[model samples]
Target: MEGICFLPTFLVIWSSSTFIVSYLIALFEHDVDVIFPYISEIGAKPPESCIFGLMTIITAFAGMATIYARYKFVEKLNEKAGVPPALNQAAFWIGMLSCLGICFVATFQETTIIQMHDAGAILFFVSGVLYTTLQSIISYKAYPYGCSLALCHTRTGMATIAFLAVSPTIICVLLHRTEDKDYVFHLVSAVSEWIVAFSFIFFFTYIHDFKRFTLKLRTEFVS
Candidate 1:
């Protein structure tokens, strides 16, 4: 159980470190603006791009593990509470799709494949927001079993903020595209992207619940 808790904790730490390290390298190389550069921009060029792509790939795997563990955890609780599994199942699939988006973003560099990179970003944000929203509802539904009211509220708030932030991010990105070097729109989009991304990561703070559950595997051989 304790070991399972580390999954989400590691996801948070590794993802944040990936962004920070890539950002610093890009900054020192004068590859990005000092203020509010798009998260993808820092990873668009040479050495930093390599690190970003590799680390983000690992982060995507970590995210998948954390999300799957969470899905199982909620499923168990819902089963015990005699609640239907539809919502939990939906959330699990949506979360997996969001992680797939992360892989897409990591593989497609913005400079080399701008269309793919943008598509990946949009997929990640939209799926992530939906995932969190569904999980928040699941948390409330599972409250009587193991989830706390406070945790439910926290998840709800973070999901709402991520949802709100994504709208401005998309709007500003589109607006920036129409203009010539509009730093203001770019800055707004960058800031909003950070907020949404971190909010998605932070929602994994529910890792505390993982302490009550264990993940195990069994192998069987068939003749």
Candidate 2:
């Protein structure tokens, strides 16, 4: 009980501090490269640096809040019977091992075995996604666990596809005209698109579930 009481306080402070720092980094780091001629550029430099700085800080805080909330939710689930520590530990170890294996395989491959390295990377990601999905099914199906499972699946797919899609485009762009920054920006855009897509999917799913739940409650009351 006492432990639960401090969770919220820790979350508030952790998220707030991270948000401020992230916002400042984003604001001060902006350059002409960030601007898109067709669309408006956000956080463009202005005379009132403090205003943007504050906004940046708040945005950073909000990002940190998401992570903080996730941690708190997982902790609460552990307190409940949602997932045992052993299962959680196993899933973590498996994921870590998969990452290490992929890194090792990639390191050994020279230019002649680039294809092999790529294959290993793909296999690694696929196994990770399947492993996470299975683990989620084995664990109790509740708020944080279920949500984390969905997020993992979504993020895994995004990462795999984003790398595949962006890598070729970046390589091609670099081949034609060399600009490291341009390639990086394009890669970032591809990843941002995935995040936006997932956000919309999550938003609609939540709304649909809420409506269905409301309907069920109304039916029960009427009966």
Best by lDDT: 1
Residues 1-95, model 1: lDDT tens digits = 37588888888889999999999999999999888899999999999999999999999899888889988888778766644588888888888
Q: What are the per-residue Cα lDDT tens digits for candidate 2 across 17-123?
A: 43333335444565323332100122223322334345434433433333233333444556544665555555555544444434433343323354554454444
TM-score of each: 0.96, 0.32
Worst lDDT 10-window in candidate 1: 75-84
| Residue 124 in model 1: lDDT | 90
Off by over 4 Å in 2: 1-44, 47-51, 79-145, 148-223
Cα deviation at 205, candidate 2, in Å, is 8.5
Q: List the residue pairs that clash in candidate 2.
A: 19-60, 19-61, 23-56
Which sections of candidate 1 miss by over 4 Å? 1-3
Model 2 reaches what TM-score against the true structure? 0.32
lDDT of 2 at 89: 52
- Go through the candidates in order and give each one's C-alpha lDDT: 0.87, 0.38
Cα shift from native, residue 67, model 1 (Å) = 0.9
- For candidate 2, the per-residue lDDT at 204 reads 21
